[model samples]
Target: MKIPQKPNDLNEIFKNNIIKLMKLFEEKEVKEFIGEANNKYIHWDKLRRLKMPGNEKPDMIWALIKLSRMVTYRNIKFNKYVFNYSSLSEFQKRLHLLDKGMGGKILSNNGSVIISSQERERYILSSLMEEAIASSQLEGAVTTRKLAKEILRSNKKPKTYSEQMIMNGYITMQEIIKIKEKKLTKGLILKLHKSITKDTLKDKKYEDTFRDNNEVVVGDSIELDKIYHQPPNYKEIPKLIDELCEFVNNDEKEFIHPIIKGIILHFLIGYIHPFEDGNGRTARTLFYWYALTRGYWLFEFMAISRIILRSKVKYGMAYLYTETDDNDITYFIDYNLKCIEKAMRDMNSYIDRKQKEQTELLNIVKKIKNINLRQAELLKEAVKESEKPITISEVINTFGVAYDTARNDLLQLSKSGYLEKTKIQKKYLFRINKDKIITELK
Candidate 1:
């Protein structure tokens, strides 16, 4: 994409009469400059489309953006990167609601306000799997969700580059969960990169190593020279990374909201591009790491990647908006907040649908005296349209039960004629018998 044109110099516009800027700002049109969703935090690229001139031109919009910024870190002044809006607008407040919704109100297995430990574990596994699949897809890994999930659930070895990428994502996310309480360090960051890109990068030597050469550039394959971003120089990477860690570890300083700080960390990794490969994956993973570390526990189960994948062009544009417009970063923050909002909405909807399915299953299985909730849950999944044939390994992974327990659960269902069991290649697979299940319900 062509680089966005920079806004005209605001200094030149206000050089003669500084009060002219104030008078112009006081005008009714200026006061009423509320843009639509498309115009929210109007970047110069979009603002230039407006029919205004001189001081009232799109440069005025840039001026407004600058005016809106509230610097979070006073120490980083020259390239004042960390910032947010001076005041939260209604739009931002609504998005904050979504961020807060991570603390979901759903009842746990124990009928408590807090999630039961068992249910929380299940949500974490589901989240890890989702993030793995979606993060890999974002980085151009091609594989079906069904197959990727099966590979993870069965603990089968990954056979292809795409599958490896998915597995790497799963492993990296799990590692992040374990280390969430630890402070960020260069070593930990490198370890994460290694875990995410192992067996996937073309140059095996560069798996965990920060790029030591200036050859990295972000842009389209067709036009390599038309660089979208040239990250900080390789020579400066070590110091930059150290500074990033310090910033992330600073909790006692003038407080930056944890959610916003997490978004900033996500943007910084992309801006720095410390790795030769897996930068996007690492950046996204680090976003999760920061949120979880900062006590945004429910963020573990929200798949931001799925929301971002739906509008990748906008995702890229959010970065461009920040880079082109004085490194305000509010643009990127706004975009991420929107993604989190949508993700939380999606999570809530998923819970509602799953609860409905479970309720229906309970209603049907109430007549059967001996079955457990786990059995009923599996049966509910079996009746879904185009459901895949089940396996004991899948049951083990799904319910986090032991191998013996999962095997017995399926065996009991099969014996009751709710499932048809068959063996292929020494592995037992169970297919749902829809007619038998319906008859049992009747």
Candidate 2:
């Protein structure tokens, strides 16, 4: 008899991951990790409160979740590079493995390998993740080319034709820029989207290629790759994506931390495998965007994927441990939290050092007599931007007052002999004198 496909019956990955994570909330390690590190590295609190440039703070949460959906997808795509591939040459030869399980495509499991289907599901997820960049940024007019441009802007490289051919679900980075530069019409998005779909249709022609003559998947049917059970229907995936997108956007219920929610979103999305091609990437990116949208930047600053990528076994094991024993998503959440906590710890230390220095500067400012608020701040900026002193024009620009207002702020401290003025033509620049903060007031 054939083995059953899929590992479990749970429909939501987030629900499972979150359920597992709740136990650690009261632990000493968890407490030390969040409170002591406050507003430093894992600044989920800060991000939650942040004001997005063009939108309200709360509304930005959804946008961030959307953004994370894509970024998570990208991180996972690059991650597989470390495994599966023995060498770059081997990958270049066999990358066609990308299309097998895309769009609900599945193959029968055989011995050792899902040989016909190896890596196809993964590749499809990567393409879906790539689509997210455009989905979040451009909205209705998104095309494959537009999506490619979005990736190029973020990753800082142009896409080649081969790259576009491989990312059959979305536009190549090269084509995205082509549209932006006015070389391609807005209508081109329709053509490109259709073209990618058409290209993917050809994968059916090669189904046998991924399959052996035996009509079953080959290679290691290790615990990781075998259909934990039958992969779900294609239509069912979008529902999970929509539900998760909503969960991350929730504004009510403050006691449950937003950081927890972000991690939960990642777990649920990964488990759902909503997109045939880009589940892992989508999970990570949405995890990020979820945090970002929640104004959780201090925590988001850590780039969770970089942490997860640092050790694939731990990352995978975290999933396996939580996936089996129960429907608990706790392990996944805790692992992500720890990864974020570590990043925040690094950031917090840096912040604490800077803040300590800021305090010292403030004390020095206190010693200067007749030092107005502007000059005190100027001193602070001078120290922070120690590479150079603040220019009079910069002070004026920062304050949005008169040029003379800038000069006078500088002049008061200068007369106190607490500041030194440098001149170029008609303009003056100011620098703090040594011990000036101490000398000016007395």
Candidate 3:
């Protein structure tokens, strides 16, 4: 993407006409515009396209909006730059909703747990695969979602670099969950980076180490000549990272919400660009790590990257807006909040759809004498993909159960004529018995 237009300086616009601008802000139309603009956190590029209220110029209106934002801005000093964010009404609404949805039990409108304990593990596994694939894809790992899921589910060694990236992401995500309770430190960051970039980088030496040179710049992969961001100097990385660790580990005097703090951590890794490669992947992983550690347990089942992949342009523009508009990170914060909200919504929709399917499958399978919920779920998958064979190992991974338990579930279904079991080589493969299942349903 091309560089965004830098916003005009607020001081320059309001210097001679501070009194006139303050009076103009009281106008009804201008008040309405400011309210609407603040709700969406509109940046100058988009704001300039909108027609001004009455006779007001866009730049003048922008100055008014900036002035309104100044009162609510909370500042953080990182190195020499002063980065700030405003928690607008919309932001608070989102944070409240996200806290309600993710911090406690996720419930539907009717007040029922969206995911039960029995099925929570399955949902988390599926979401982790999705997050891993999308995160890798964002960093230019080119592999089909189907192939990536297959590689993860079957525990097959990745034969290609793209596949390796996906596997590394999956591994790193699991590792983050295990170490969520640990304090943030430079060594821990290096360890996570090593796990995320293993076998995916060109040089092994750069795997867990900070870059020593300043050649790295984030640019548009499509438009190779257009540079989107030039990170801080390589010499500043150690100091920057030390500050970041302190920021993450210690609670601020003036309360910064955990979600917002997590998003800031996400942005800092990208801004610092401490590593030669895999910085984007590392940044995203840190976001997940921070959220989960803060007791937002429901985040384990929501893939924010999947939602982000759909609006990749907005994701890039959020970073550009923050950089171009005087180090105001509200733009990036707003973008991520929306992504998190959408991911939660998407996850709920997915769970609802799956619940409906399971209800239907259970209704049909309840006619059978001794089939269990696990058997019903397995049968549902088999019915959906009748041509694809199922393996015990896949079931073990999907259900987070042991090999014996998975094997027994399939074997019982096979013995009851719901599935046809055959030995392929030394491993057992189960196929849906289409005719028998149709007769039973009928």
Candidate 4:
């Protein structure tokens, strides 16, 4: 991506057009335009293209927007820099919706659970797989989503470096869930990085350790000459990380909403670039850890990375905008909040689709007597792909059921003529008995 043009200095614009700017601010249309611009948090690059009202220049409008934001910006000290962000109306509206949606209040009108206990596990597993694949893809992992899901579900050893990256991401996400209760520490961060970069980095020593040399610069992968960011000096990593741990662990000084805090943690890791590889994956995992630990239970079902992967350029620009524009992290925070909102919407759509599928599966069960819900689901899947053989292990992994339970479900379907079972070596493969199912339904 090309580097964004740095915003013109706000002070210079104010100094040059003091009387004109003051008079424009009093105009109703100018005030309305400022409100609209601030709500979207329009950066100068895009702001400059907008048609100015009453023949005023776009930079004057940008100056006014910056002036308004400065009043509400809150400061955070990180190492030698002081970063700030403002909670605009847009942010507040989204946060309110997210709090209502993700704070364990996901229920139907009847006050019963929207996602039942049985469905919760399946959704969580699907979400983890999605996040793993997309996060790896964001880092340039080359694999189809279908192939990646099959690799994860079959628990097979990855055959390529790209697959290895995806597998590492999956394992790291699971590990984050397991250790969500622990406080953020440099050690914990290293552990997560090790899991995320296992067998994927060129050097083994860099897997769990910070880089000792300032050789790493985030540059455009295509152009190779355009540098996007240069992280802090390598020698300062330990102290910077120490300060980061304290910032995340202790919340007494000020009140940052849990979601915002999580996004900030995500941005800091990317900014710090403490490791030689897998910094992006580690940063995203830490965001999930912070959110899950802070009681956003619904995040386990939301794949924010999947949404981010759809707009990879914007994701990169959010960081660039924050860094170039005087460390005003509102750009990063705003981008993440929008991604989270989309993820939440996607999660709800997924639940609705799954619920519809379950209803259809129930209808199938009514037609096929003596079959359980699990068997009915298998039949539904088999109907969709009759030629593909289903294995006991696949069933177990998909449903999170015991080995015996998966075996019994497949065997019962075979005996009932809903599936055709064949033994190859010591393993049994089940396929849809298309003729028998057609005859029975008739």
Score candidate 4 by lDDT.
0.88
Instruction: Estimate the lDDT of model 3.
Output: 0.89
| Model 3 ranges off by over 4 Å | none
**Taking the tens digit of each residue's C-alpha lDDT, what string does model 2 give over 1-442?**
1221223322343345444334444445544443333212222223445453334333233223322222322121111111010112222222222212122322222212221243333223333434433332222223354445334322323354333333442333223323332221213322333343333333444311211122222113455464432333444544444554444454563333556665666676556544333345445545554554444423322334445555555666565544442334544655666676554444445445544654565676567545655577677767555556566665543444467877788888778766687888986767777665544445
What's the ranking of the predictions by TM-score, best on top?
Answer: 4, 3, 1, 2
Could you tell me every candidate's TM-score relative to the true structure? 0.89, 0.35, 0.94, 0.95
* lDDT (Cα atoms) of all candidates against the true structure: 0.77, 0.43, 0.89, 0.88
Q: Write the per-residue lDDT of candidate 4 for residues 209-238, one digit (tens) a residue.
A: 999999899998789888999999999999
In model 3, residue pairs whose N, Cα or C atoms come closer than 3 Å (at least 3 residues apart or on different chains), thus clashing, are: none
Tens digits of per-residue lDDT, candidate 1, 1-442, equal: 5677767775675575467667665666665563332246667677678765344656654565444343331223213344333324744585477555656566434444433566566667787888899989988989888888889887778999999999999889988988998999999899999999999998999997899898998887678668888887888888888888998998886677788778888988999899899999999999999998977877877889988988887888788877776676777887888888888778777776666666676787697657887788788778884267888888777767788999999999999888889999999988888887777777
Comparing 1 and 4 on TM-score, the stronger one: 4
Cα lDDT of model 3 by residue, 308-417, tens digit: 89998889999999998888999999999999999988988887777677678679768766887778888878989999989999898778778999999999989988
Greater-lDDT candidate between 2 and 3? 3
Q: Per lDDT, what order, best first?
A: 3, 4, 1, 2
Off by more than 4 A, model 2:
1-230, 251-255, 348-442
Superposed on all Cα atoms, the candidates' RMSDs to the truth, in angstroms, are: 3.4, 22.7, 1.9, 1.9
Model 1 TM-score is 0.89
TM-score: model 4 vs. ground truth: 0.95
